[model samples]
Target chain A: MSVRKTAFLALFTTFSLAVFAIEHAIPPLVPIPGIKLGLANVVTLILLRHFRARDAIFVLISRILLSSFLFGQALSLLYSLAGGLLSLCVMAAVMGLLQKKALFLTGAMGGLTHNLGQLAMALAITRTIGVLAYLPFLILSGILTGLFTGLCAGFAGKVLAPFLSDIS
Target chain B: MKKNTAWRKPAVIITAFLLLLSTASLLCLLARREKSDYAAEIFQDGVLIKSVYLNDISQTGTFIIQGENGCVNEIEIRPGSIAIISADCPDKLCVRQGFISDSKLPITCLPNRLVIRLRPVSDSSETTAVPDAVTY
Candidate 1:
């Protein structure tokens, strides 16, 4: 890869890591676990749009791995990886299958898939079907939060278009 | 695939559909919350460890719940609500959940593989709700 490409990836990864740390500091909106705004996903969405899925995955994994050391527990890494990889795949597929300017919808899809992935992991680890009770609530939160991040990505992309041209 | 194809049209329709579906299901699940005559059921790795009728408890106390590979959680039992007061798991999400008095949502400690939820007394427990018919 060229120097510019490598630099762009590094910059995006840093941006995502910063967002993850910031989001981590804020207490959960609800006392229940596994619910959050997922603000870092805005960086992933931006990268997915401006760059390739490969670049977005790089940043996503880096952010997850790095943030665990800073604020997350060791076991939480499994949940983050599961949710992150699944959401990335779904978001990329949505972006590919649909036309442009559907950022919000793509984000909502990503959010739904992210929660489903985590739920699956929880079920396997806990070995209880009762955890499935979180499905509807997770889906609702995922959609809402995903939409918010997607819109943030849209505006950020608009603002960065001039600067991103050279890197793209 | 290259054309814009009025993408907003389908996106809006699908968003609306998902919003409605999730909202309806959430309402359905939440309707079971805060019922009278509830029982607290604790489970570890899909196995029922203990259960107590909420109406019977006269005061608050704690139960030490154990999980696979030496995991532990201190669950506080109150008159009608259950809470995880402390835990040794990596993420203390269960402890932060405070208390739950109904079946609306279970307090689950994923790290420890423990779950605490409330059920109405009239409803049968997992042990007694066995299937009677068998064919081989």
Candidate 2:
């Protein structure tokens, strides 16, 4: 089981990294910064449901670090790390409360907090309240994108759950 | 899935409420009519590097912002507008943002932590008259 877990975690990390790189390669849908579907978050949602919290965090941190090194600048690393960790914490807490039933709810809340964390980081870095202007848009986009990722993860989890258990 | 319906009711309501609230605010922000006369302030690394009054510019030229991190963003400053004409950042989204002449939107270079906003020129000098004192 331990060996199998390692393999699964490795595969998840690889997939998340590939997704992150692919997201970067694709042109941003909105010309505005900080707007995206965050497709790799589906992997995080899947890990949260199927694996332990630590495994999810492991995949998240690895994806952020490697993606930043491969395709991002130094400052973006801080931004992504802040957003990723905060979103994961929110997802984990919501999962605990709801017993992991409403995956979309957890994802939505996670998406909101993710933008919030990055917003806070941006505020701290800029030391200006001007950036607060982005709040409403961020919240709106976060929920919609999060809901999308959450639903995808839920469907994927349902389809893959049997296969995972059987193979392991 | 037996009791799933119970919690999902409130969850859906909450999601809907939040979505509505954010959308309302976003629309309001967009619909705002702003004054064209303001200072185009450029800040890099959160420090004020340049502030040009859009309404009262004696010179129209471009300047290159060479950030400490070696990011170069060339800003094109015209009389009534300003824009990031080019940038060395990977995304170049700032350049794509085009020119902005009002306070409604700002041209932001995310990688370099650069922000260019059209804010009301500092209202400090009551004696210098309101509109035409700051232009060089």
Candidate 3:
């Protein structure tokens, strides 16, 4: 990659991390542990389309890991890892298969997958299927959050379209 | 041609998740009907602060009791009789969790450094729900 591309990637990655860190600083809108506005994923969806999936994956993992450390919650790292990996898989699959016009749908799926994966992991670690009781609430939030972030990403994609039009 | 098919993924996943959640809820309700004596310990900083039975609280009633430390924890015993009610915690996430009786969910108060947990009937070998392990 050229220096300009590398510089852009670094700056983008840092910007993404800043969004993640800042969102974490805000108290959760709901007292539920897993729900959040997921403001940072808007950046990820944008990166996924503009940059390579590998780079987007890198940014996602790096941000989650670093954010977990900063929060001083090592136990949380497991949930984050599970949620991030699942989200990346689904998002990349959908984004790769669908056209640019459908990017918002893919982003929505990513959000849903992220929440589902986290809830599944929480259930496993806690050794109780009772945690599954929260699945509906999480899924409902996932849909709403997904739509909001997807729209945000949709606009971000539009803004970056000119520069990224030729990447593929 | 394939336009609407894309929507199928989330639709399927969400439906499946909802079904599973309902199943879990039903199972919890069934389990609650069983007659079992449960001992829950509310521990604060390794000290046993409170102990209560699972069957002690009815479906609709306040489990609120002041501990010796003079802290009030509002426990709600409902269908899912989860014990951690209201706490002095800044987060108050535990308070909003509602009643959880399913033995799977534990009530946690971050501010008070307290955790209310349910142990299975067999594990309730101790005569008192509160263990002798911690200093009051």
The reply for model 2, stretches above 4 Å from the true place, is A166-168, B1-6, B9-13, B31-35, B38-136
Poorest lDDT segment (10 consecutive residues) of candidate 2 chain B: B127-136
CAPRI-style quality class for the chain A–B interface of candidate 3 = incorrect
Global lDDT of each model?
0.80, 0.80, 0.69
DockQ of each two-chain model: 0.15, 0.13, 0.09
Q: What is the C-alpha local distance difference test score of candidate 2?
A: 0.80
Which digits, one per residue and each the tens of the lDDT, describe model 2 over residues A65-151?
A: 888788876588889988999999989878776677879888888888888888898889768676676787788888888888999
lDDT per residue (tens digit) for residues B20-94 in model 3: 654665566666465555666778766887766666556566656564566667876554355555676466788
Q: What is the TM-score of chain B alone in each candidate?
A: 0.64, 0.62, 0.49
Q: By DockQ thresholds, what CAPRI class is model 1?
A: incorrect
Report model 2's chain A TM-score.
Answer: 0.95
What is the lDDT for B19 in model 3? Answer: 54
True contacts kept of 2: 0.17
List ranges where model 1 is wrong by over 4 Å.
B1-3, B6-13, B34-36, B39-136
In candidate 2, list every pair of residues with a backbone clash.
none
Scored by lDDT, model 3 comes in at 0.69
Q: What is the TM-score of chain A alone in each candidate?
A: 0.96, 0.95, 0.91
